[model samples]
Target: MPIWVTEWALIDWFAGPDYPDSARQGEYAEASAAMMEELSIVERYAWFSLPYWDHIPSLGLYHPGPVATPAGEAYARAGG
Candidate 1:
């Protein structure tokens, strides 16, 4: 069976034009890219739009049903 993975954009809460410079945004992007590359499932990634007040981007990871691991099994059972 093929494996599937998901990713989300994690933005910096303190990031803003008036705020001091920071690498938080870059770090998030890098981490997300690294995970996708490591899993070799970049296409499976999904990201939700950030709300006006929320800076973090919501992400979801989904794989085939009947997962082998307990966590995956639980997620599948939960219909996630």
Candidate 2:
């Protein structure tokens, strides 16, 4: 199974909260698509399963709840 875990403090250390939302979305889309593509390949084919996504929005990490982020949308498209 694939999973994406996010730690706010770790992200803050590398890139402050000031990081552009657009840039983050772009990166999220790229990452989500890459993961999906990898999982879709015959060489990498495996049982399909919804990716486990963990992030605490209260702590600043993106949440795939009420509001869907690019990552969440991509995951949905991948049949999550």
Candidate 3:
């Protein structure tokens, strides 16, 4: 048998300049309650991705502390 793991990121890179990419993503996450609710079909290890210690761009869920990123909030609300 084999096992698979996955993580997702809600990027807002295309949002207007007024909002930073992460901020835009946070806004989306606050509004993706429904979408988050529907992402409970994880048959294996599935979760949201976030920054990490030392600012390394790796598959992580924390960036030195409690991350309130839109995507993270959504993932938490959605039972991730």
Per-residue lDDT over 1-80 for candidate 2, one digit per residue giving the tens place of the 0 to 100 score:
55543221113445444333534643555565556566633223222122324432322223444555554454446554
**lDDT of residue 55 for candidate 2:** 34
Clashes of each: 0, 0, 1
Q: If both were scored by TM-score, which would come out higher, candidate 1 or candidate 3?
A: 3
Name model 1 segments beyond 4 Å from true: 1-7, 11-22, 41-43, 50-80
**Order of candidates by TM-score, top first?**
3, 2, 1
Error of 2 at 66 (Å): 2.2
For candidate 3, lDDT tens digit of each residue in 17-54? 13335555555555554554545552454554555525
TM-score versus the correct structure, for each prediction:
0.31, 0.33, 0.40
Q: Of the candidates shown, which would achieve the greatest TM-score relative to the real structure?
A: 3
Tens-digit lDDT string for candidate 1 (2-40)? 455543445344655232112443344445555665664
Error of 3 at 39 (Å): 6.8
Ranking by lDDT: 3, 2, 1
Question: Which ranges in model 2 have alpha carbons more than 4 Å from their true place?
Answer: 1-12, 16-23, 39-65
Q: Is candidate 1 or candidate 2 better by TM-score?
A: 2
Model 3 is weakest, by summed lDDT over 10 consecutive residues, at: 53-62
> Which candidate wins on lDDT?
3
